[model samples]
Target: MKLKMYFLLLALGALTLAFQSCDDDDNDGISVPAELQNALAEKHGNAQRIEWETKGTYYVADFYEDNYEKEAWFTKDGVWQMTETDIPGLAALPAVVKSAFESGRYASWHVDDIDKLERKDVETVYVIEVEQGKQEMDLYYSESGIFIKEVADTDGGHNSEGYLPSDLSAAVRTFINENYPDARIVEMDVEKEMTEVDIIHENKAKELLFTPDGTWVSTSWDVRTSDLPGAVTAAVQARYPDYVIDDADYVETKENDYYWVEAERGEEEVHVKVTAEGVIL
Candidate 1:
């Protein structure tokens, strides 16, 4: 399996917010659920260009806060799940959190990106990305200063002199150039199912898996609720007006499109299945 590791660059005093996607009107034609709008207004008062979608069972709001980019996740009924804020330095983290983070295996790795992920009942945690040579890892720490787990690990061997192939798709090449400009392909393997390439970025290493047509296929990236289609989000909101969606997963097959949604109201949580036509099955 090819692992993908995405880390934010630590640019000091950079007041501009450079989002992953530049399209501000992406959510214009899509209908925003009233519950979602109210939730955004309540939690993210200053958030701009609030774009939303159903991700898993959460309604995710992707927006800009101050000079930094932020993403907030809420249940369909408007209960908040978590919010992530881009930050700089370990100084912003709690003393215990920083201590636990520094004690991890990748402690000496170069700091690539840092963010604060806050949830209601759970302790606040820091999502940190670090790089060492061509090796990169993402670490998570609790507010009480305990290492939670390593979210992603992209370290691999860098001797690709005999592995890398000359023929690579434009999309694959562009993805690497834009995301990992400082990285290089060190190893390549062609399997019966898909093609995989080992890469090293600033000493950190990771392998990439691509389909026959060069479509990236890997779980290295976490798909947020905001990444779902608008129709799915709208359908979820309409059908479960009384329940708050906690997470949602879209399932596809040759015959049907189905959504598995987890919802909550007060202390009761229920899982519901909905079809593409907005009918709860």
Candidate 2:
């Protein structure tokens, strides 16, 4: 009995020491090199809440600036490697990359996150995370937006499940900025067939859809009352002086474009449809 108890104690001590060694190895004990820290300070002004960790041969610094999440990587000798800026939606991607991603392989996969990576070599790549159901992947694209290849996903599960290349993302954003300046996009969801961007104005959500090539697909939000063509708003006011314009939307179908307006008076609501020229239909 005494011999068995001694062996058990010896085994436990060995296991504890092994665990401690493993923990230390995982920590790496890497500190930010002075050169890397100075380079980062010069490049990004002041990094807010930055966290540093070693990955492979690179040291990654994750930080935030102006309410945006960004990552910077540096070498052990303090060489600035690359900076990655997380784009909120595909609409913000560069135009060339956007076009290539839409028509390239894995376009069907839903895009989740887009990181615009800039390296000291003056090379640029777009790291795009895409997923469908259970399967997830990361794809790399060239500076002009050509397909590269798949990379192992390092972002665990932070980016939401969706897919879109940056260029196409930018086009979508441009359309919204040009047409609906007041609405701000909040969430972007990509599907196999279409991409949807949700925007908000005055606490109301509006959904906009686009094709993979950045073609405007459809919208679920009423057009801003102020953005309505003067002719349309004028006609509505002339026809129903007491009613207030509550909703407006410019809709396009294969057949023709339609201007839709909804007006309200007390408890009464009215729907008016017209052509772009303000001709009531």
Top TM-score hit: 1
Instruction: Give the residue spans of candidate 2 off by over 4 A.
Output: 1-33, 54-58, 150-281
Query: How do all models score by TM-score?
Result: 0.40, 0.39
**Residue 37 displacement in candidate 2 (angstroms):** 2.3
CA RMSD of all predictions? 25.3, 14.5
lDDT of 2: 0.71
Full-model lDDT for every candidate = 0.64, 0.71
Query: lDDT (0-100) at residue 108 of candidate 2?
Result: 91
How does model 1 fare in lDDT? Answer: 0.64
Across residues 2-33, which tens digit of lDDT does each residue of candidate 2 receive? Answer: 99999999999999999999877555444676
lDDT (Cα, 0-100) at 9 in candidate 2: 100
Give the candidate number with the greatest lDDT.
2
